[model samples]
Target: MRTLPPRIQNLTNKVSAVFVPLTVLLALSAFAWVLVIDNDLPAAIFRGLTVALIACPCALGLAAPLATWMTAHRLASRGIIIRSGDALENGGTVRHLYLDKTGTLTSGRFKIESVTTIDETLENPLALAAGLEQASTHPIGDAIRAAADEATTFDEIEPVPGLGVRGSLAGDTYALGRPDFPGQQPLPADTMTPNSRDKTHTIVLWRNEQPVALFGLVEEERPDTEAALNTLRRLGLNLHVLTGDASTQAAAFAQRYHLPVSTALMPDDKRQIIVDRRRETHKPIGFVGDGINDAPALSEADLGIAVHTGSDLAQASGDVILLTDGIAPLSDLFRAARETRRRIYTSLIWAFAYNAVGLTLACMGILSPAYAAIAMIGSSLIIIWNSTRGGSLWLRDEHQLTEEDPPTRSTNLTA
Candidate 1:
């Protein structure tokens, strides 16, 4: 099991430290009441000295809530309507992130990358092929339709379940599908390999009992993938891709930028994978998805990121939501969160520093309740000012990850 951080560290107790003076003042208040009623002059004098501390400003209490509100509101500006502040920010603290493949990271629109054919032109062969594919609602069909654009001339069309479709187009009889289809095509010595199928989609095209072409459907990667991923890396965050698609495709995606991928996983299977990882480490896990199928994994993750185009339910269940159609906006999400965190740290730092100074003055009986209130209000104002400064200029750009010069996590090393 590997251990990474920004681990489950809570600032609740430390932040609660501001209440110290208030508590002491409260106890003195009780003593003062007793002294006044009991008519004890000596005790009354002692109680009166600590009475000023009761004015300790409670403004620091507003810090966390205010920061949470501002950050969430900013996220909403980008169309990521947050259900709660907890989910928006929890992503920042997460050490591990899981992303769904289709419709999430990619545009979800599958297109024909290229038509592999030994013949010169693709017109006649593709005409009959598109006719059969028109009957299906699957991604493969969508790719064929997108490529063919204007409908091909079809005379007769019939489909054989689990096999291929028989059709005639462009005044020629044709059968377009796998060799498994009736009177389709002869099998080539080598068929679609596990590796080729992963990186690109395999849609067999048959014509007249002979193999005509193999159409490979390719989904375009969102330009922001490189940038968003680089930002995560800068933060030293570990990324994982979990999807129902084949590991071959997942591996191909990973290989592009040295990513780690998981494949052939169903909805629940995705959740189980996250569950398995959880057993090995205590670090928080963040899941990213843009499909209904991702709901299970989204729910299971410590932090779930449902993209804007994702299913409504998955979006509702997710911890964080990205507004941009691509991963580019997520860089902003991280930027804002990292700033919020940094500001929180700064707020805490000043909070402690302010407390130290206030306590010193308090012990000397020089600090009054008004002064404590002023200090509390002042410190909170500073934190409020800082959290609004969110993501940096570099984060707003999409190329932060893909540039020839990989962006750096810090000022030192390049990504």
Candidate 2:
């Protein structure tokens, strides 16, 4: 599949755009100068041809793009899908990481704790809540829908960014989200206690601006979460969490991960935080998320990583999609990006060096047109080989990847 062009590739194109005309002018100058001096038409023509061939810019154009393409292909083979060359280039440079709490660091499979209804008139609050959450991709919604007997449809379902969902069911306005979610009036007099200290999240359901039901859910960390965090720490990334969860829940998650966090933030708040951090540090920032609410931050960050199981909108906003379960592959991603960049620069340097030396020799009459053509082809071949070499190494048995690791299922809905 075609991916977005890398910055280096665009630079190469721009350079080639200018270099092509300059090359033609230089070639014509060499031809005219040699003909005027020696009066040898054939020799002058050969000299001009040599100059043109030597200045082809073939190697220069291939250097960065080839290396990046190879890196992206290798990553795809390992179940990591990089949607853009810029993402691959920036992945290695991310110094700070902001991660969404739910469905990103956690397993995303929520266990239903309780579905309590304060209103006696409501026939089945869980069913109503499930109906509203049916259109939601959040783990909490999934849990609620799974527990309900059947999910009925709602009209005009609208998601409140960083909050909850609202819709019309049976000609009545209903909402489901955090207790503090706007429009949820007549708050529970008993103080909707947070059981987040015990790893549980509380969500309130409202009908006509009145509290109807509360859903308590518990989320567990993924099996590979700790290892991923450790790897990121070793890489020296400043880690933080941005979540719309309650302060108590956010604090619990942050404390568990030993990361500073911003709690009860809107989607815009998360995006603004990333913007501010980028301006202050002047460093690449990464945001990892798996929900609709995280789309804004994902799009704003320098590197946006989405889990494969995330919502379609979240995946669309991300630059990189992790197809493998958990976040362990993130460490691999950074390492591969660094390696790709190294290859890109090394190939570019080699290309430029070849052009400089080859052009000098061709112009000085030390090299013939035929030899210059051969040298030009040789330089391009070397760049191609170098670009493919690192990718080939990924197939070695020592790398531990087996035949069963499918590479063709990049768009599959699994993590």
Candidate 3:
């Protein structure tokens, strides 16, 4: 509750402050009226007590928190753990959603899609690339190693973070990584490009100073991604891909998914995009990511969601965590938040209306103390019932994956 926006807390506090004193004045007026008209002290005291009790803002107090509690329970059952209630509240207002590419949209598993070599006479380029990447743990390196023959071997390997790997093979030095690596030349313009629709990423293999081949690797999108994106779009959210991948690949992926793309981003670059979007759009921005590289962007977003499978740093930095794979839970989260907000408004509206009518009748002496008590209890019950209704509306049929659905597992990168 303390984390709730100050405006909301202040509004509630102000209402409560005025309400208590107003109720007390109403009770005093009732007491005086009844005593003067009926000449009965006991009856006046009873009416005064009834007015005070009925005017208590129990329904008002329960409006937001009760709905929030119910929403938390429903979302927990659906594999989304909300770390902050305030975030959940704010999530309903999000108009833009920025998603990380790896481990979020894509499966984070890389596989060698195809390999192209500049020299037909050269032995398998994949084998040489694998030999150089054998000691590396990067997803791309692992993919190259997995595609190569098991007999491939290397000596004196040196790994460069975010670039590639280098090693001595058969008394010759070989490098396998990005084309822009130090002393590496770019592929010729006449070189055949991979299918743009496939959106494959390229890693260059170098034999000493000469670029020998290009390895095309692909990351599969999660099965639930399309449906989740469609749902968010239907909810009027502007979706954009914020990725550290090259602009060409990111643009391809975004085109395939029909979303805007921001590419070639550093960690700080991703944060800056979000900050700029927030300022320009003046709406809440939700970011979903699952890597140490995503921590800054996640923290910078208005609502940050991390997958349970993400790195510890990402999980800790996120406002919400998905216990399961895929983006289906994100849709559920937004639906639940929207529904919960609706319920709160409904409860508050009904509470205010009920109180207005009941207090007026009590002041006019048209409602007996006994009946006023019943009406007050009935109003609270109505609010509670309204709040509980349709709590599970967020769980869509598509969210329930059948046994036939492909299981999300780490790819055998070094197969």
Candidate 4:
């Protein structure tokens, strides 16, 4: 409530500052006229009081904040935590949406789709890679570790940012990461053919500067991803994917979903994409992401949405947090924002129109002071009633659809 734009409050304050004296002047004019015509001082005073009471601006004061509070409450019940009311206010106006690939659109959990060994003597390459990645916290590392034997161990594992993990075992250094890790020895040409499909990401394993194995890992799009994209498309948003994954992998995923993709982006690259898109489109951009790398882009977006399962940094940087696992709630969020905005405008118009009518009646001596007070109360009640009319209908519809169409996980192979 406190975070809502002060435009409405400031406008009302300024109007009230001018209104009070003008209202007093109108009331005094009425009083003087009644006193001269009817020769009744008490009746003239009553008319003056009626005019003052009718134009009190109580409904005007309550209009914007009350609508904001109602919408916030409604959104909270639907598993969407709005960190900034301004985000909610502008959510409906978002014309461009940039979604992250790994966690936001697809399941972050990756599984080994295939593994190829360059060295036949390198036995148990999966176990070796897992051992090197055991201490790392990246999703790919976790996936590798989870697929391998838990008992495997390594010595002094070090993570190379944007590359892979490296460590030593029995005086031999082993690394598990992208094919280009160490920026020296690339993966053998034979292993590159398997990634041509570009549906699955490849993780390379190296032993003492020699490329030994290539592990193909696959990530499945979330079951709700297609449906969510469809819904957003229907809402007229221009959707695009901005990912740190390889160009082939990101392009393949975007092709499957029929959305444009900007691939192989660094953290700063993602932020720059948002800046460039904002300038090109001249519209609000909403970015959805859930990783440490996404923090910068999330902060740069006009409206940033972080999933509940996202990294702590991502969640903190986002303007809104999806308490639920999927993106389905985003549809409801858009509807709620639009509806809330509509109700605010409705309340403001109704309040202003009601005051105008009531003031005219009171000034003309057609309404008594008591009746004017009742009318003022009635106008406030109407605004409150309008604000409370739509109660989570969109959320209920989304839940029903979810129940009818349960989410299923399916994997894709990427290079």
Q: TM-scores of all models? A: 0.65, 0.87, 0.75, 0.81
Local accuracy of candidate 2 as per-residue lDDT tens digits, 1-415? 3356888889988988887898888889988989999999999999899999987587878888888877888888899899867987898787788888888888889978877778889888888888888777788888898899977678778987778899897789999998888857846556465444458888888898888778888886788787677766665566788888877887777667677878888888889999998988898889999888899999999899999898899999999999987887787787778678878889888987887787788778788888988888888899999888855433333234334322221111100
lDDT of each: 0.62, 0.81, 0.75, 0.79
Q: How many backbone overlaps does candidate 4 show?
A: 6
Greater lDDT among 1 and 3 belongs to 3
lDDT of 1 by residue, 373-405 (tens): 566567666766765654443245544444423
Q: What is the model-wide C-alpha lDDT for candidate 3?
A: 0.75
Q: What are the runs in model 3 whose C-alpha is more than 4 Å off?
A: 1-14, 33-40, 112-198, 203-216, 398-415
lDDT for 96 in candidate 1 is 69
lDDT of 3 by residue, 288-358 (tens): 99877789988999899998877788888898899998887787788777777777778888878877877
Which has the greatest TM-score?
A: 2
- Return the clash pairs for model 1, or none: 198-249, 227-401
| Rank list by TM-score | 2, 4, 3, 1
What digit string (tens of lDDT, one per residue) describes model 4 on residues 1-415? 2355635556766776777788889989999989999999999999999998888576777776677677778888879888875776678678778888888898888888888888999888988888887766567877887788653577678877557778888898888887667554787676788865777898888888889888888886688888888776666567788887887787778778887887777788888888987887698789999888889999999889998887898999998899987788888887777677777778888987888888899989899999988887888899888878766554555334433234332222111
Error of 4 at 332 (Å): 1.1
- Winner of 1 and 4 under TM-score: 4
